[model samples]
Target: MKLPLKRLLGIGAIAAIVIVIDQASKFTVRNALAIRETWTPIEALGDYFQIVHWKNTGVAFGLFPGVGWIMPFAGLVFLALIVLFYKPILNGSFSFAIAIGLQLGGAIGNLIDRLNPEIGYVVDFIWIWKYPVFNLADCAVVIGAGILLITLWKSDLAAVKKAQPSESGDAFNKNFNAASAADKTHE
Candidate 1:
């Protein structure tokens, strides 16, 4: 079934915003710094927080490197699954929509980099402590997944509560038991 135009537009807008910001930040970093160059804005926090120009040909946090060619295919499959199973997102609350949008935007942002003939790797700049260098797209994807988990947890709790027998049901059972006892006595 077709989704509501308004809802689709809202989700699309969120995704577009993520893509634009992610791409723009990556572009800025690539132009401003040479590859492997680091820039620390705060002197004291330099060791903890800094931006560096790095490239990852693999998935998040540079995992499974040298498999860049397969990423595009995996991304395409991800997009297809999102489109095919969108009913749950559409029926879910606003948070669910936001989660979906963030995920889509992140996936597309990385896909764009992988598709680029000139730079067939994702640009990552943000650096925090000893963590692997990452980018805004990665952040969005992680945050989106977190939100999705929370929403699913809440929905499960609601379902469980609904499935439990109500107080009225308990009262009815009590009355039926009493009637059955009376009938046995009469018999």
Candidate 2:
């Protein structure tokens, strides 16, 4: 198969996996714990970490609570943008594909929660020391964003390297200038 087609398939697969995992984890959390309920899986880490069934009607990390009504619209816009620019944005890189897939999944996962009539808020369970409760979707988004940044950085570095003249080119230019001067002197 063509590389672009392969990449698209890979991206779709990764996104589907992320969405399934995120949704399944959220479902399990919701069923196992009531809203606001907390469970400490490791007693030794109880002070540092716990699984809490928390709800957020806002963006990631519980920011801007109660503004979730706008999220569905925003998510739709994001999906539209992805559909419009996936080729250029992905740049035919596997890393870029993975990053976009992860982000897409995360966005869709949270959008699903926001759009659900029964549960209009995102279900967050994972919690760390003094940190806001979040879910697998949030983790996927963050990690995907990080990967995207790294991929962009690497691409920029490669471009810069390609733009700069290599040592062999510099040596050839010096030799050509010397030969030209020699011929002019011999004339």
Candidate 3:
């Protein structure tokens, strides 16, 4: 439950960066699409990617629509994950910590977006091949979560292997040594 000062500080800093990037990109998109009025596809991967503008009032992939209550619910889940995983997340491994950082940072980013908007709409502007529009934060969260799950699964497998009774020579060495000592005393 305890987090080292360095980790706590690193988490805070990354979260702040996420917020900044999310808001800045949103503002730019809003100005271009609303205030200044439009951007064409920044580039095209033969219909694979584009930079477009859309507003989403739901979780990733536009899962909900017009459900006003879900934003805060998403935010709560976000907060809970960060708190629950903080310590092991910090101590675990490289990929583990980075994945957690990405998740934590992305969560904070979207949560901030929902806080002030009139209907809790998030500004989403990235366009990917035939997919629902999303923003930087969404990408971070999804990729991070995927990596985190993979790491957890791998570690669980490793622990299981280690706990199995193995054929190694050191297996129960101390126990056998103690038994031999007792036998000598008896003789």
Q: Judged by TM-score, which candidate is best?
A: 2
What is the alpha-carbon lDDT of model 1 when measured against the actual structure? Answer: 0.82
Scored by lDDT, the top model is 2
Candidate 1 on 22-129: residue-level lDDT in tens?
999999999999999999999899989999999898788788888777888988898888787666556567887889889889988988888988778999999999
Give model 3's TM-score versus the native structure: 0.74
Q: Model 2 over residues 58-153: C-alpha lDDT tens digits?
A: 889999998878888888898898888766654447788899899999988988888888888999999999999999999999999999888866
Candidate 2 displacement at residue 31 in angstroms: 0.8
lDDT of 3 by residue, 82-130 (tens): 6776666566666766676777778777777778755267778887788
Candidates 2 and 3: which is better by TM-score? 2
Winner on TM-score between 1 and 2 is: 2
After superposition, which runs of candidate 2 have C-alpha atoms over 4 Å from their true positions? 89-91, 165-187
Give Cα distance to truth, residue 157, candidate 2, Å: 0.8
Candidate 3 Cα errors over 4 Å, as ranges: 1-3, 35-38, 42-46, 164-187
Q: What is the TM-score of each predicted model, taking all chains together?
A: 0.85, 0.85, 0.74
Q: C-alpha displacement of 167 in model 3, angstroms?
A: 6.8
Of 1 and 3, the candidate ahead on TM-score is 1
